[model samples]
Target: MREIDVFIDTEEIADFFYQELIKRGFIPAEDEIRELADITFEYLLKKDIIAEEWDE
Candidate 1:
């Protein structure tokens, strides 16, 4: 199998969502935004779209 390294800036992603929501006039809470981001990451991980890195 081929492997690739991916760097994800989760904070940046959350910030982007927050900004978009604000522009739409739906101001979401910080925790809500974070939870949404977590759910997204979890879905991607489950589908093998992304992998969690282990620290040795």
Candidate 2:
């Protein structure tokens, strides 16, 4: 998984990344976005960078 530390440090960055993913057609729908968020959350959890689920 891609490192999520930068995005975790800034909500704006996370939003920007999400937008880019959509713009690039990497994520096609809200569900995919949620899935990506889940993956990122798991990654963060593994790194112990975040403990709680993100309010998606």
Which candidate should be chosen as best, given lDDT against the real structure?
1
Local distance difference test, candidate 1: 0.87
Give me the runs in candidate 1 sitting further than 4 Å from their true place: none
Clashing pairs in 2: none
Reference-based lDDT, residue 46, model 2: 93
TM-scores of the candidates are 0.81, 0.49
lDDT of each candidate versus the true structure: 0.87, 0.65
How much is 17 displaced in model 2, in angstroms?
4.3
lDDT of 2 by residue, 1-56 (tens): 77564345444445666799878877556666566666776797798877664666
lDDT of 1 by residue, 10-45 (tens): 787788889999999998999999988888778889
